[model samples]
Target: MLFGTSGIRGLYGKEVTAKLAAKVGNAMGGAGRKVILCSDTRQTSPILAGALAAGAMQSGAEVIDLGVGPTPLLAYATFVEKCDGAMITASHNPPEYNGIKLFSKGGEYSKAQEKKVEEAVSSDLKKAPWDKAGQKGRKDFSEDYIKFLIARVDSQAIGKRKIRVLIDAGNAAAYSIAPRLFEAAGCSVVRVNCDKPGQFTRNLEPKPSTLSESAALVVKEKCDFGIAFDGDGDRAIAIDEKGVVLPLDTQLAVFCSHMLSRDHNKKFVTTVEASLSVRETVERHGGRLFITPVGSLHVADEVKRQSAAFGGEPCGEYVFPFATPCAEGLLSAIMVAEIFAQRGPLSGASRGIKAHHMARTKYKCRADMKGEIMRKISEKPQLEGRLSTVDGLRYDFEDGWLLIRPSGTEPAIRLTAEAKSEKKLSEIVQRAGNLIMKEIESAH
Candidate 1:
């Protein structure tokens, strides 16, 4: 499929090109359709964005271009403007990579929607007549998006407490807006790596390994906490007061716990790859847990379908259905600050949440061989657990579970196994690794 779990993403000039972007735009265009378009800070973003706009215009789709904005902004704009949305971003991928993400009704395109686009891209798409072609216009909605967030959050409480925060935009799309959003919310904002758009001083993905510098700054500056954003600002990673970066699963659990505490509705959504800790914590709060395949698109769709209180991924992508349908990192950051404002420190909230010993590893597999390799592995002997093949192969055991799946965004197979005890986790990991390697060898 041209579309991955999230959107159509790959290396810029190779897998993702201007030609492809234009084709996608043309395929998605229709008469009287309004599409809100934006791009991240990648050098090639402008080219792709323009090509997409051109194609859409040729097909009679009115395009409102928000030249350089984050993915969250594009999503919000789509809802506010009552139009479909398109964002040119590779998300957390490296600089050489770029991709296009399409949104309809304020969320990523559903799998069925994506399938239609793929089919149209392959076929001969029609264009509008000379006078019937659409027009392009420009506007900046950064301030409006900031206002929308501020209106929903406890800005007064956040400001009253004067929560000091360090925001690491990673020199990408969120650089401009995040600082402003936090400052408006009454936070004493400290900015780093927010200077330039295309110049990156750190790894784009906001993980523990990539956030050391930001974490240290949070401690040194005596801030309440810190937030680090990924390349396109769709994901956020938090740094605690003591310069420790919170684990993705732990942070997700904390967010869920906080949200459940706020509303009477206990419907929460998380992905299949989420930690057992998340499930336990949600259930403890009398929240109903819903699991979907490993993608924010799936999470968002499930959230809307079930009227979920909140949805999040272990990777820090959170969807606040009440505020917007998209997985919003900017909103997640502000919500973290509000947690401190309404409650106490995050350290206190994270105290009782359990942590598990989990092992994760990936094996390289040729992209074209993924289907055959997965088929061979699925045909192998079963493990001792309840099995699920929702996104991949998952076996749930009494004390732990094992999951083996092909990476949706890369040419590899990922294995995740978790257990109550370290020894049990190690055993599960060993067995899972052996199974994957044996199948891969046979396929080769």
Candidate 2:
């Protein structure tokens, strides 16, 4: 598939290349079509983005080059400009990888739209004649985006509190904008790994394991809290004042609870991978939760369909439909700051939310074997629990649940298990892993 769960992602020169980027641009570009283009901080990003712009301009589409910026910023510009957009980024992937994410004026391309792009790449794409070729221009909307975010939240409250924040942009796309947003919200901002065009000082993904340095610095610097953003600045993981990395699922629940408290809108959306804690918290707040397949695209689409207050994934990507359809990590961090202003502290945000023990592991399986393996596993069910085939096979027990799903972006099958106790969690992981291995062995 040209597009995976996210977009066309792979190694820089292998699966992802300048040729592919140009082809994708040509596929989306046409006479009189205006396309906005941008890139992340990866060394390979500029070349790919330039190639895309070249293709788009060659096809008689006016191109606006925003240069290096976050994916959310690109999406925002696309919406305001009312044009098609493309971002050259591998998102949370390592620097060695790169990809292209497509956007329509409304939101990310839907599955049907992705299929069309794939078909276009396989067919002949014509270029505009020299006389009618499109033009390329440059623009920056950073100020506008920051102003938009400040207006979305209680800037006055945040400003009055004078919240102290430590922001780690991971030296990626949001290097300049993230700190500026926090500062605009009237917060005293301390920055780390926020330098422009610098190689990633830490892991790009904003998970607990990858954010220990930022978490420790949060307490050392006596900051109110800390925020770590992914490579493309679409994911933000918060660190408590005590230098604790808040559990992903717990963080989601706290954000949802805060949103429910502020607005009368009682609808929310999340992915199937979200913890039970999220559903419970949403229900407690008198908010309804809708679950979709794993991916920000699914959550974004569901949020729009339900007119939900917002949507998010446990991995730190959040989408406020009123703000923008793409995951807005910068906005999410500011919301965290606003929460700190309204509430007491990050440590107490999840006071009443129960923490669940979760374990995750993946097994290497060729893409071609995923279908047969899933079929075999489904045919030979060994667990006597409530089975749900929403995105994959999920069995919900009274105290926990197990999910066996094929990776949409990689050649692997993943297993996620959550239980009330660590022992149960381990048992579930082992059993699920064994079951998947057995299926693989049989398929072989």
Candidate 3:
């Protein structure tokens, strides 16, 4: 079975069933003796975690269930508890969607490890003796996790700025941590939709379209900026003081530039979907940029392999190698503060990070036809430029780039192109999208 870009996420009762969760738990339990479980505010999370615990327990693995926590906290708690980690969450997905995330001490489970788990669930899984059934225990590692995260940043530097931030948690797991973290760092914290439950008062994912309310609040409250965390708190999107939601790629570029300035030779990891501005910013600061196929785990593993200090995705996933591999919103919030205190506000700090015009669009197609469509697109001899098929088909030229890839989470083909100007970007995007649509039609 194919997994999404991240984990086994879907509408809870349908695509992600309790039986499926248990089978995955049985597979995951084989990795270690003590397994730590974490979850978010989704109503189905607790139920799924229970089912997973039942499965893991029967596999002779002790379950350390940490209920209603963020994804990254689970990743960090693994070191403190000395155990492997699993999280029940569907990061940034719809409120009805739920999934599981797996992690090792170094980081998220690698592709090879995911494949192993996938194979186990597909076949009859292993089980231990009745006498050997592992026991279940509970722990809340949030406070310890908060302290550990605090040590990773320069709180003194951030406190000097005394930045006041407005956070829209979207009524998810971020509501549990972001306020406490900013307060601890000496920043005045204002909450919008923070105290609400997991039912989600707004769209779970924070995007430009979904942030009008937050943007207006930031301007009205006179905040330095605003933050909106996705449903699981593993991803975050930001808005500037002027009620302007910052462009995702430019936000990523600013951080990459700052991180590279600290250590010129350090490697920076980002997904292929990242903008040309990322490459420009990293190279301009004398740091090497390593591109990987999309997926937070993929970027995390690549960061470990390349000894990269920082990794980011255009979709707001940020990874700090020193603390943990998972993308923790609380850490990202402070890191954003530290950068502001040192460099300037995001609006000012982003001036140096020049970005090219980009056009991105998607066309719906059946999942079953994706492979055939991709194959035919690859066979096109008339297409130009150096092609990189690492994730899909990415063609690079002197002034621009075009990427056509099938969405792992949906039955659609995503096309993205970037160039120096809007006219060029639109031209490339249109041509690339038309070509892919032809393949989609031909696949039928």
Candidate 4:
């Protein structure tokens, strides 16, 4: 029943299972309305998705299956078809895990609505009479998705360049979508681990360590650029044509710069986890930067309310508000491609952008200790920092900041630190982790 920073995610069979997924579906309700559903290539996803669809049908909701695509594809489909949606994927969680994420008609879900869905599932509400059962159908929206992406860019410009691109799907759902999009955009694609509907060939996260194979592929293939997608394909990490991995902050700056320069007066929304440099970049370009709590949902919600041009997290989740009200890897990739086409190599384009050092350290603090740790951190008046309890406890200092929050799905706490240097970032992260551990031990 745990909902993480994204959605309901947990270790499969242990905390998440088909039966529970079905219950969640029933709670969300199909009500004879079309509901778009999709899943990644996780081993347990199809089973859990089937149960979820059954429950939705039992609740008299029609299901449109967008098979084995990213969560954003499902989100896009939900908006295109004007249907509520659900995606069965644990995103960047490990192979042993799976999850379910619900989206409203516009591919966005608020915390309040998420709670409603959770409560509905918890209550075990009954389905409508059998005579009102909903139907199920299937569709391959990948082609349409590609077409939509192509429409956003000047295809002629991209084709003229004939960019050589390397793609690492991370054995996630993007295996089917990314290569196709690149090819359709007239890029000569060099693919690695692009297999769809198979075992995860790499660590689920698309971070640098997990994407060494991608980097090697980029260098070996001499590709123009490299891209890596996480499990559900909502987040993307990029490797320059030189086979250098671009940090999230630099990537955001690139995206924001392109967006703002192309369309002035656009607002860029981000979380506190975003580098302070991003805020400076946006402001320098006559655009405003809106900071929210850490989490895509929070950013997405703010984007919708403010009609912002773009939104993203430092962790690589990028959202184009004009496209859909959710972070979309496909869309972000297309935007990156356009940036490449317009500005040449990524390395050349990323010049003059302020770069900062950041590090994330996670600790195993049981769920029971989270509250005590929060209290102890809050009581430390000597900290002399600005504190935000938005997602968890985030303390902002003059030169750095740290966020300590309980993992929504795991019995652990996530600690993120950002500063001017790696040494300082690491020092603050370790200090925060130690202090939290001490509090937990004392409480126990």
The lDDT of model 3 is 0.82
List ranges where model 3 is wrong by over 4 Å. Answer: 30-32
Model 2 over residues 127-201: C-alpha lDDT tens digits? 899999989999989999999989999999999998999999999999999999888778899999986564888
Model 1 lDDT tens row, 1-444: 799887988889999999999989888888899888999999999999999998888889999999887899999998888778889999888899999999986788888889999998998865999999999999888898899988877888898998999999988999999999998887889999999888988999887788988888998999999999999998888888988888888999999999988889899999889999999999999889999999998898899899989999887889998777888988898998888888878787787789999877899877778889998888878567899999899999899998889988877899988899999998888888988888778777
lDDT per model vs. reference = 0.88, 0.88, 0.82, 0.82
RMSD of each: 1.4, 1.5, 2.0, 1.9
**Where is model 3 poorest over a 10-residue stretch in terms of lDDT?**
257-266
Q: Candidate 2 overall Cα lDDT vs. reference?
A: 0.88
Alpha-carbon RMSD, candidate 3:
2.0
* Residue pairs with clashing backbones, model 2: none
TM-score for each of the candidates: 0.97, 0.97, 0.94, 0.94
Give the per-residue lDDT digits (tens) of candidate 4, residues 1-444: 356678888789978899888887887775657778899998899999999989888888888888788988898788888878889988888888898998886566777878888788778555768788888899987788789878876688888888898888877889978999999988888878786455787887877787777887798898889998888999888899878888788898888998887775578899877777788888888888888887888888888888888888988988776677788888888777888888889999888798777777677766667777777867875444688887787888888888877766566777877888788887787778778777777766
Per-residue error for 286 in candidate 1, Å, reads: 1.8
Clashes found in each candidate (C-alpha, N, C closer than 3 A): 0, 0, 0, 2
Better of 2 and 3 by lDDT: 2
Candidate 2 lands at a TM-score of 0.97
Give per-residue lDDT, candidate 2, residue 60: 89
